[model samples]
Target: MARSIKNPKKAKRKNKESKKKGEASSSSSSVPSMPAKVWQPGVDKLEEDEELQCDPSAYNSLHAFHIGWPCLSFDIVRDQLGLIRTEFPHTVYCVAGTQAENASWNYIGMYKLSKISGKRRELVPNKSNGNESEADSDGSSSDEDEDAQDDAQPPVLQLRKVSHQGCVNRIRSMPQSPHICASWADTGHVQVWDFSSHLNALAEMDAEVNTGATNSFSMDPIIKFGGHKDEGFAIDWSPLVPGRLLSGDCKNSIHLWEPLSSGTWKVDATPFLGHKLSVEDLQWSPTEADVFASCSADGTIAIWDTRLQRTPAASIEAHKADVNVISWNRLASCMIASGSDDGTFSIHDLRLLKGDSRVAHFEYHKQPITSVEWSPHETSTLAVSSADNQLTIWDLSLERDEEEEAEFRARLKEQANAPEDLPPQLLFVHQGQKDLKELHWHAQIPGMLLSTAADGFNVLMPSNIENTLPSENP
Candidate 1:
């Protein structure tokens, strides 16, 4: 019997239904569409009238933070209660930037959560009191001084300066220290900053103080690694090793760096090259520190074992257009997910090699997949964002019948033994946005994900849910 052709219409309908069921189960039975708000210039607050333009059922909960255009950088800090630090969780920090000016770019003001209002507001320090300005010879405050001191007390919670004047694309916390690795586009430099000291320096830098006179303020980067003639697009520090770092550039090269005994860092090896076009994204394996993955504009994902010299240990010709992102499964090191400009996402298993040494592949999306991220906490859950302005989450652990699992295993085994073509499982698709550019999963939250687009809106969504909102034009 001849094999049946995969019907695109039938597949799409099934996916739509599956998404609806998933959303209905997770959220309250009712689903309502959220209306879009008009954009007004210089609006510093999210008003009640301007609720999220997407569906409430689409996201788990809304956490609003005002930001600038081209929001190129973000970080997630987990609280002791195991919740991702959104505004309601005491404090949150958000950094955003724009590339409007050449050579000189503006680092917008940093904002923090207000203790009184319970919303994000621009950070400003309280004024000092005149009576408390001078201390008595006995080192005790007078009655008048005591009264002023209370007024001059610092804000219960404040958003202080973290860094300034640099185009930071990504920030990765150090495994050992309280330091973080920050990659910059303008300087082509990667540096480590002590968070405590960095924040203090940022406050002084933004303070209204005289620059010509000597002041008790100094800000210095602890360690700086130099390379990359072009802009650095993506950077990653080894999850296992503290100081070892890997960065990819617009020049289509990956450079490795390590700290040296002389108190400085040096390039440990020659640049590794495999992709024909610019390298867009790179990530180190969660399980193995020496192993890493890189995706490029050449439309390929290459897995590299740093110990290998000439070429990648394994390669997947997965996408038809530029491969924008690739993420490794935290639970299964052998499994990988990738997104491409051709409007498709693919899941690959490195163990399933064909006769020609190609890896196994499964297709997921019909629009340019701009971003893909695997959940850090869950092994089988993955998230993807696309140019079609949709963010979809996949639950690979969903209960599957024995026959289905066996068929999938048989297909994988056949690819390992002999090359054969196969399609991937159709996961849920959250379609609502327009021109999506980035996708990120909250590090601490298992099901929460963030998706941003060129339309100046960054959305948060719950995994395994459907967005019931109507689509808007880009």
Candidate 2:
């Protein structure tokens, strides 16, 4: 899908409706079309139109977050209650490139995420905050959250912008780390920052020094991991091992970084050269600390064992075009999914230590596959995103009949173009936005999905998926 200048892409989704071509698309005659929303620009503010925009009963989705500049990447932020709110959570971090009128440097903004009638909203600073009335309590100022009056215009919350030296390509929120996130840029570097301490002091610092405008939180990098001569793009923080970082660059140089007690990251002396071309994506094995996988523009995905750094334990030329992304099944460590520019995704079973490796392959995409993520909650369920702006939820639970499998092998033996196919396991396919950049399963919620796209961000949930889970209401 072509990315829009008005908005960029990042999203996650799954649906209970079966999308097997025979199943009908959900009828939306009663559903109202989503309307475009505008941000007030700076911090802690949302436009107050009397009519509420949220209508999940009809739309099955909610519009959320409006960073003024178009964003390329984003990661979720946890609220103070530790709940995952797809709609205006406590905070969200996004990386966006410079606009025509802006400077050359790219920008990163930390915005307050919130919700109204289940609709997600980003509260940017209001340009008209000067005349806005904020309720005062006693001699002390009222809490910012409490002072957001309902009758008049809403008060601005907070918006902080930081400029980067290069175009920001990716951002990954560290697993289990409330404050730490890694941001990679075209400058061939990955920066890790812990902003938890900075946030609490921000308001106090604002009071201490009367800055006319909101200053971007000036948090320094806790650890700077660099060494790639080429622009670095692929990065993954090991969820199995704390503080172990992996980043691969355009030239296929992969470096390992480990955080040391001295408050710095130690970069390995030699780079792991596992691919002949740029590494497109890296994913840490969900079950193993010593194993990780890298997909590359060289049209292969290499499984690297950190213990044996000499070379990858296994490799496969899995596609006709560059392999753009990879994901490991969280429930089944032996299963791995890799997507390619050839518009196909192949699932491999690494447990098969010897013969014909691929277990299944899907080739329905007509454009480059941008991202793939295995659902944290379900076994054999995976999400695939395409440059064609499609999100397909695939359940790889289909088992093959022995006779049918043999027939396909016989055909492959007889004809050069013979095909091997897996049984239909498509659960749902959704279309929205101009470009689909990322698909992520909400770590805490089983049917909830967060998606980023060229037009805007969407928080979606499958209406039917609710029946399969233990409902909060029930």
Model 1 lDDT, residue 366, Cα: 55
Give RMSD (Å) of candidate 1 vs. truth.
Answer: 17.8
Best by TM-score: 2
Give the TM-score of each candidate. 0.61, 0.68
* Local accuracy of candidate 2 as per-residue lDDT tens digits, 330-364: 77778889899988999988877466568888887
Where model 2 places Cα greater than 4 Å from the true spot, the runs are: 1-59, 78-105, 116-158, 198-215, 398-423, 466-474
In order of listing, the candidates' clash counts read: 2, 23
Q: Write the per-residue lDDT of candidate 1 for residues 164-242, one digit (tens) a residue.
A: 3456665555444423444455567666555555333433453233222111223556666666767766776777776
When summed lDDT is taken over every stretch of 10 residues in candidate 2, the lowest stretch is: 1-10
Between which residue pairs do clashes occur in model 1? 343-367, 343-368
Residue 388 alpha-carbon offset, candidate 1, angstroms: 2.3
